[model samples]
Target chain A: MSDIVTAAMLVIGDEILSGRTKDRNIGHLAEMMTAIGIDLKEVRIVADDEDAIVEALNAIRARYTYVFTTGGIGPTHDDITADAVAKAFGLPCEHDERAYAMLAENYAERGMDFTEARKRMARMPRGAVHIDNPVSIAPGFRIENVHVMAGVPSIFQAMLDNVVPGLKTGTRLISVSIHCPAGEGTIGGPLGEIQKQHPDTIIGSYPKYLDGKFWTELVVRARTPEALAPAEEAVRQMVARLTDSAAAI
Target chain B: MSDIVTAAMLVIGDEILSGRTKDRNIGHLAEMMTAIGIDLKEVRIVADDEDAIVEALNAIRARYTYVFTTGGIGPTHDDITADAVAKAFGLPCEHDERAYAMLAENYAERGMDFTEARKRMARMPRGAVHIDNPVSIAPGFRIENVHVMAGVPSIFQAMLDNVVPGLKTGTRLISVSIHCPAGEGTIGGPLGEIQKQHPDTIIGSYPKYLDGKFWTELVVRARTPEALAPAEEAVRQMVARLTDSAAAI
Candidate 1:
């Protein structure tokens, strides 16, 4: 397996930016990427404008191993993700026959006419492969490294379930958390030194305020359990020593 | 008032990227920005790495009217946002006397030692103005167009309340929402025409799946009520016409 497989998420929507909608997709994708050993390196949320979508899509897709985008895929004027992605890749976007057939059949089965607007869902960048959406028949597409999906959380998740199995994964990261009764103020100095000593591990100190008192949680992550254990132990010892000294004082 | 005021949010943290923390600040800030007539144009969530922070901060602050960053202001080795913002502005990052006085007094009042680690919370870019935090004594700072705030949701909100008064606002946006019993596929064609007819207003169609049926909510927004009213009425008439025709068939 690769040592690190990285991904970035692009949320394309006006509702989210306008505060009319709260995004549930970013957290879902972030957690999904983490569990599958892909580091979600960055996330960019842009509006539904084609120019903004093309610009952001081009920027992040060039840097990350994979880019997942949500929103702007429905059959509406604002649903311009397909065209924007095609522009980003410099490919001609047209109605894919397979996608057309799928959506056509779905609407037909429901005794509905697959209008020109419904057929718009079938459009994709040339040479793109359809990502199956069991929730709704309108398929998302994969053009190069970018996986474009719907913005709705349920459909996005359903599409992701179909996409995850095919991705190149990295070595699973091992994480250990140590709770500190003391605040980062009391332990941050020594914790920095421990981080320096354990160069292979990532040590993160998160502060939490509860019941009018502040405390810190230290999480150490490494590629292997062997690499994680020592850093975890060092953090535990540092918290114990500092909290003990603070209590004594 | 300005016709448009745009802002971007940069979230600095590994915890958010790693899926250990779900971001509440983005939604909170987005809603707040919209309410205050500022367009939240884009949002970028980056890691705690200084280079990443500096790059993203520079990219966004140069484009938007203002840039707000959340996270990495705490007293820890991983808290690198202040230094990163300073680097982006090519300024010296050192202990701000006012922030130092505020945090030191808070620690003293709480019967805690203001250690070197605690003092680290007082650091800010040179010539930055401190944004007051009522939830915590450690202040967030604003240098140039960038406002660096805390990761904790409560502290971030409190600091935002203090920062908003100083910002330049635009004309307040007027929004009208109309629900459609039909899906976007059924109403999308005429809706697109309505959007083209009202170029001054932004028409957004949001699809929702409830009770095994897909419906849409159309929201029209414009800077003035006059611009918004006509677009909203057009959308309402379009949805009514489409759903009625669909029902007749």
Candidate 2:
């Protein structure tokens, strides 16, 4: 028996859509999820509107094992992710004492007022568990399987550390790369057959055009490294044959 | 009357989800769409699976005026975007004579065979119009409101240039920015009220933490510069009042 855990990231922000901010959270989450053996199946970026965020959260969280959302958790009118997450689950949001205490202490230490806007950071959906934030005192939270994290890279990454250890691991994928100088047209037919045979595995062909010449990087992936040997051999042999035929012609 | 046009982008690739390749297409599309007055509303990254592509295409194309897809139109077994597009629209795909001629001649000039894999690039959904590719002979195609382009950055950018000119123009938004070294908690309440007053305009507050200090940049956006005078004055006055009160306290 095997377990495969899948995840999806919902990036909530108007800045990202407007081209004002380049997203670092999705790529970072992609790399981190892959490293931890969780398959990141999909990523959707929506504007910082409440209904949009709520709709996206409901759709993606239902499809994947875990859902992580970045952005719109800060202390501003634009930061509406928390409210959206609450509305998505039909849960009432209230001031969380632990989060309030943490933020109040941080604000006191900095000799700043714990203003009403700052208080917004302390609100959490009912029955949700709080996530730790090492960067700032304001914390993210977890409701069901969905984890809400800060949009800022430093805080989001810090909060992710808290969420990762609790997730179940799956079979780590093994990758085999073959750099073929042959264009995709020369290899596409045989490659399709290989993919059909290894239906359980993932075969991806990335075409590259550099140095005024075209080439392809063939990537074969599966759960087990030991099982990839034969498939890898098939790909290598196929590429070799294709390259030779092109030369002869 | 404000001609408001909205668009969405579908990034088709397994590489992006696997973190093997960071997406450049989304950011580039975001920048271009924003500059040309088309509001880039939603962006989704999906794997190269046909069902996933079709689902994403149908969902997004129905919501926005235009939908632009990048990747999966290449000379490889994994390149199935054309087939997916055809399935989504219930149209037959065929080898476009114009696309075939362009690719065949390009390959002939390079002394390469017009292999079946290369021929795959010429296939388009029925009734689709071709978009030119200045870098390579493989052309992108437009069917209904959806435009499908190559995943490679250079080629994707080239195809985008051709598709963008044909899109409907909207009332270009005018933006006004004011940087205040006040925490969002100190200004979010007032800003929300300001936003309520100018319901026609879009107000975004971006918070920043620099040099051990808190600051925020308030951005006001509206279609007409003349109409923005009152809303902008109110925002400037609010920020000034908030700044003054904090200083007095």
Please, what are the lDDT tens digits per residue for candidate 2 over residues B1-249? 548899999999998999888888888898888888889999999999899999989999999999999999997888999999999999998999989999999888878778888899999998899999988778999999999998989889989998888889787777888877787777887888888888888999887766656678888988888668778999899877876776512
Q: Which candidate's lDDT is highest?
A: 1
When candidate 2 is compared with the true two-chain complex, its DockQ is 0.64
Against the true structure, what is each candidate's TM-score? 0.97, 0.94
Candidate 1 lDDT by residue in tens digits, B30-113: 999989999999999999999999999889999999999999999889999989999999999999998999888888887888
Cα distance off (Å), candidate 2, residue B148 = 0.5
Off by over 4 Å in 1: A242-249, B243-249
Cα-based lDDT at residue B186, candidate 1: 84
Q: lDDT per residue, candidate 1, A1-249, as tens digits?
A: 457899999999989988889999988898888888999999999999888999999899999899999999999888999999999999999999999988888888888888889999999999999999988889999988999999999999999999999999888777988888887888878889999999999999999988777888889999988889888888887777776785612
Candidate 1 lDDT score at position A184 = 84
> Candidate 2: where is the Cα deviation over 4 Å?
A239-249, B210-213, B237-249
Ten residues in a row with the worst lDDT in model 1 chain A?
A240-249
Q: At residue B239, what lDDT does model 1 achieve? A: 71
Backbone clashes, each candidate: 0, 1
